[model samples]
Target: MRENSCSEPRLRKSRLGSFSKVATTKPNSNATSENRVICIYTYDWTDVADVMRIRDELRKLGITSRIPYKSDEDTMIGKYRVRGDTRISKYYE
Candidate 1:
Protein backbone atom coordinates (compact mmCIF):
# COMPACT_ATOMS: atom_id res chain seq x y z
CA MET A 1 0.00 0.00 0.00
CA ARG A 2 1.16 3.52 -0.72
CA GLU A 3 1.76 5.69 2.32
CA ASN A 4 -0.20 8.90 2.20
CA SER A 5 1.93 11.74 3.44
CA CYS A 6 0.74 15.13 4.60
CA SER A 7 1.10 16.40 1.06
CA GLU A 8 -1.56 14.00 -0.10
CA PRO A 9 -4.60 14.59 2.05
CA ARG A 10 -7.21 11.83 1.98
CA LEU A 11 -10.87 12.53 1.60
CA ARG A 12 -12.66 10.97 4.56
CA LYS A 13 -16.35 10.64 5.26
CA SER A 14 -17.85 11.06 8.71
CA ARG A 15 -20.66 9.03 10.25
CA LEU A 16 -23.15 11.53 8.90
CA GLY A 17 -21.96 10.80 5.35
CA SER A 18 -20.34 14.18 4.87
CA PHE A 19 -16.93 14.27 3.26
CA SER A 20 -13.87 16.32 4.15
CA LYS A 21 -10.15 16.39 3.58
CA VAL A 22 -8.23 14.74 6.40
CA ALA A 23 -4.49 15.22 6.45
CA THR A 24 -2.55 12.00 6.53
CA THR A 25 -0.49 11.77 9.65
CA LYS A 26 0.61 9.13 12.10
CA PRO A 27 -2.70 8.36 13.84
CA ASN A 28 -3.23 10.13 17.12
CA SER A 29 -3.26 8.02 20.26
CA ASN A 30 -6.41 9.56 21.66
CA ALA A 31 -8.43 9.87 18.49
CA THR A 32 -11.96 8.50 18.55
CA SER A 33 -14.85 8.55 16.14
CA GLU A 34 -16.85 10.69 18.53
CA ASN A 35 -13.98 13.11 18.92
CA ARG A 36 -12.38 13.04 15.47
CA VAL A 37 -12.88 12.06 11.88
CA ILE A 38 -13.24 8.37 11.20
CA CYS A 39 -12.97 7.05 7.68
CA ILE A 40 -15.53 4.45 6.68
CA TYR A 41 -15.41 3.07 3.18
CA THR A 42 -16.15 -0.11 1.31
CA TYR A 43 -14.40 -1.97 -1.47
CA ASP A 44 -15.39 -4.74 -3.83
CA TRP A 45 -14.28 -8.20 -2.74
CA THR A 46 -12.91 -8.88 -6.23
CA ASP A 47 -10.44 -5.99 -5.80
CA VAL A 48 -7.75 -8.19 -4.37
CA ALA A 49 -4.92 -5.76 -4.82
CA ASP A 50 -6.57 -2.91 -2.98
CA VAL A 51 -7.86 -5.08 -0.15
CA MET A 52 -4.52 -6.79 0.38
CA ARG A 53 -2.67 -3.52 0.31
CA ILE A 54 -4.84 -2.09 3.07
CA ARG A 55 -4.50 -5.23 5.18
CA ASP A 56 -0.72 -5.12 4.84
CA GLU A 57 -0.55 -1.50 5.85
CA LEU A 58 -2.51 -2.18 9.02
CA ARG A 59 -0.30 -5.14 9.85
CA LYS A 60 2.84 -3.03 9.52
CA LEU A 61 1.46 -0.67 12.13
CA GLY A 62 1.16 -3.54 14.63
CA ILE A 63 -2.57 -3.85 14.21
CA THR A 64 -3.92 -7.41 14.22
CA SER A 65 -6.08 -8.75 11.42
CA ARG A 66 -9.83 -9.23 11.79
CA ILE A 67 -9.98 -11.86 9.04
CA PRO A 68 -9.94 -15.07 11.07
CA TYR A 69 -13.08 -14.58 13.11
CA LYS A 70 -16.80 -15.31 12.87
CA SER A 71 -17.86 -11.88 11.66
CA ASP A 72 -20.93 -13.31 9.99
CA GLU A 73 -22.58 -13.64 13.40
CA ASP A 74 -22.44 -9.88 14.05
CA THR A 75 -21.73 -10.19 17.74
CA MET A 76 -19.54 -7.06 17.67
CA ILE A 77 -16.28 -8.82 18.18
CA GLY A 78 -12.92 -7.10 18.50
CA LYS A 79 -11.65 -6.64 14.99
CA TYR A 80 -7.98 -5.88 15.63
CA ARG A 81 -5.53 -6.01 18.48
CA VAL A 82 -3.73 -2.72 18.75
CA ARG A 83 -1.02 -2.77 21.36
CA GLY A 84 -1.13 -0.35 24.26
CA ASP A 85 2.43 0.81 23.57
CA THR A 86 1.31 2.02 20.17
CA ARG A 87 -0.35 5.41 19.75
CA ILE A 88 -3.48 3.96 18.19
CA SER A 89 -6.29 2.71 20.38
CA LYS A 90 -6.35 -0.97 21.30
CA TYR A 91 -10.11 -0.98 20.99
CA TYR A 92 -10.08 0.84 17.67
CA GLU A 93 -12.21 -1.76 15.90
Candidate 2:
Protein backbone atom coordinates (compact mmCIF):
# COMPACT_ATOMS: atom_id res chain seq x y z
CA MET A 1 0.00 0.00 0.00
CA ARG A 2 2.80 2.42 0.86
CA GLU A 3 4.52 1.60 -2.39
CA ASN A 4 1.36 2.32 -4.35
CA SER A 5 0.97 5.77 -2.76
CA CYS A 6 4.57 6.64 -3.51
CA SER A 7 4.21 5.70 -7.18
CA GLU A 8 0.74 7.11 -7.77
CA PRO A 9 2.08 10.66 -8.23
CA ARG A 10 4.50 9.73 -10.96
CA LEU A 11 1.83 7.72 -12.81
CA ARG A 12 -0.63 10.59 -12.63
CA LYS A 13 2.00 13.04 -13.87
CA SER A 14 2.66 10.93 -16.95
CA ARG A 15 -0.99 10.53 -17.80
CA LEU A 16 -1.60 14.22 -17.27
CA GLY A 17 1.20 15.13 -19.65
CA SER A 18 -0.43 13.04 -22.36
CA PHE A 19 -3.80 14.70 -21.80
CA SER A 20 -2.38 18.26 -22.06
CA LYS A 21 -0.67 17.62 -25.37
CA VAL A 22 -3.77 18.38 -27.46
CA ALA A 23 -6.49 20.60 -26.10
CA THR A 24 -7.88 24.13 -25.99
CA THR A 25 -5.39 26.50 -24.38
CA LYS A 26 -6.49 27.53 -20.94
CA PRO A 27 -7.27 30.63 -18.83
CA ASN A 28 -6.49 34.33 -19.35
CA SER A 29 -4.82 35.07 -22.63
CA ASN A 30 -1.04 35.46 -22.32
CA ALA A 31 -1.05 34.97 -18.57
CA THR A 32 1.14 32.23 -17.07
CA SER A 33 1.64 30.89 -13.60
CA GLU A 34 3.92 28.14 -12.36
CA ASN A 35 0.94 25.77 -12.42
CA ARG A 36 -0.78 27.90 -15.04
CA VAL A 37 -0.32 27.10 -18.69
CA ILE A 38 0.37 29.87 -21.18
CA CYS A 39 -2.78 30.81 -23.08
CA ILE A 40 -1.86 31.81 -26.58
CA TYR A 41 -5.41 32.41 -27.68
CA THR A 42 -4.28 34.64 -30.51
CA TYR A 43 -2.80 31.65 -32.31
CA ASP A 44 -6.24 30.25 -33.01
CA TRP A 45 -6.87 32.87 -35.67
CA THR A 46 -3.22 33.07 -36.67
CA ASP A 47 -2.12 31.26 -39.81
CA VAL A 48 0.67 28.69 -39.90
CA ALA A 49 3.32 31.24 -40.73
CA ASP A 50 1.88 33.41 -38.03
CA VAL A 51 2.18 30.60 -35.50
CA MET A 52 5.89 30.38 -35.95
CA ARG A 53 5.89 34.12 -35.73
CA ILE A 54 4.07 34.01 -32.42
CA ARG A 55 6.33 31.28 -31.19
CA ASP A 56 9.13 33.63 -31.86
CA GLU A 57 7.42 36.11 -29.60
CA LEU A 58 7.29 33.57 -26.79
CA ARG A 59 10.87 32.51 -27.32
CA LYS A 60 11.93 36.13 -27.22
CA LEU A 61 10.23 36.36 -23.85
CA GLY A 62 12.06 33.22 -22.61
CA ILE A 63 8.96 31.06 -22.01
CA THR A 64 8.74 27.83 -23.97
CA SER A 65 5.34 26.71 -25.13
CA ARG A 66 4.68 23.36 -23.54
CA ILE A 67 1.94 22.23 -25.91
CA PRO A 68 2.82 22.86 -29.52
CA TYR A 69 -0.27 21.42 -31.21
CA LYS A 70 -2.37 24.06 -29.49
CA SER A 71 -0.93 26.89 -31.53
CA ASP A 72 -4.15 27.40 -33.49
CA GLU A 73 -7.95 27.18 -33.03
CA ASP A 74 -8.80 30.88 -32.40
CA THR A 75 -9.28 30.26 -28.69
CA MET A 76 -11.10 33.19 -27.16
CA ILE A 77 -10.95 33.56 -23.40
CA GLY A 78 -14.21 31.66 -23.03
CA LYS A 79 -13.53 29.29 -25.88
CA TYR A 80 -10.66 27.10 -24.59
CA ARG A 81 -11.75 24.16 -22.53
CA VAL A 82 -8.33 24.93 -21.00
CA ARG A 83 -7.30 21.36 -20.47
CA GLY A 84 -3.68 22.49 -20.00
CA ASP A 85 -1.57 20.67 -17.45
CA THR A 86 -2.62 21.77 -13.97
CA ARG A 87 0.63 20.96 -12.23
CA ILE A 88 0.80 22.23 -8.69
CA SER A 89 2.70 25.55 -8.55
CA LYS A 90 1.31 27.57 -5.67
CA TYR A 91 3.20 28.15 -2.47
CA TYR A 92 0.50 26.37 -0.49
CA GLU A 93 0.71 23.46 -2.86
Q: Check candidate 1 and list the clashing pairs.
A: none
The TM-score measured for candidate 2 stands at 0.33
Off by over 4 Å in 2: 1-34, 43-46, 65-67, 71-93
- Which residue ranges in model 1 land beyond 4 Å of their true spot? 1-40, 65-93
Candidate 1 is scored at a TM of 0.28
Tens-digit lDDT string for candidate 2 (1-93)? 022232245336442121212123355453444353333333233355544554554454565545443423223333333456343221110
Error of 2 at 59 (Å): 0.3
Top-scoring candidate (lDDT): 2
Report backbone clashes per prediction: 0, 2
In candidate 2, what residue range of length 10 has the lowest lDDT sum?
15-24
lDDT of 1 by residue, 1-93 (tens): 232232123223111122223434557543443333323222433445544554454455464745321121222443322323232232223
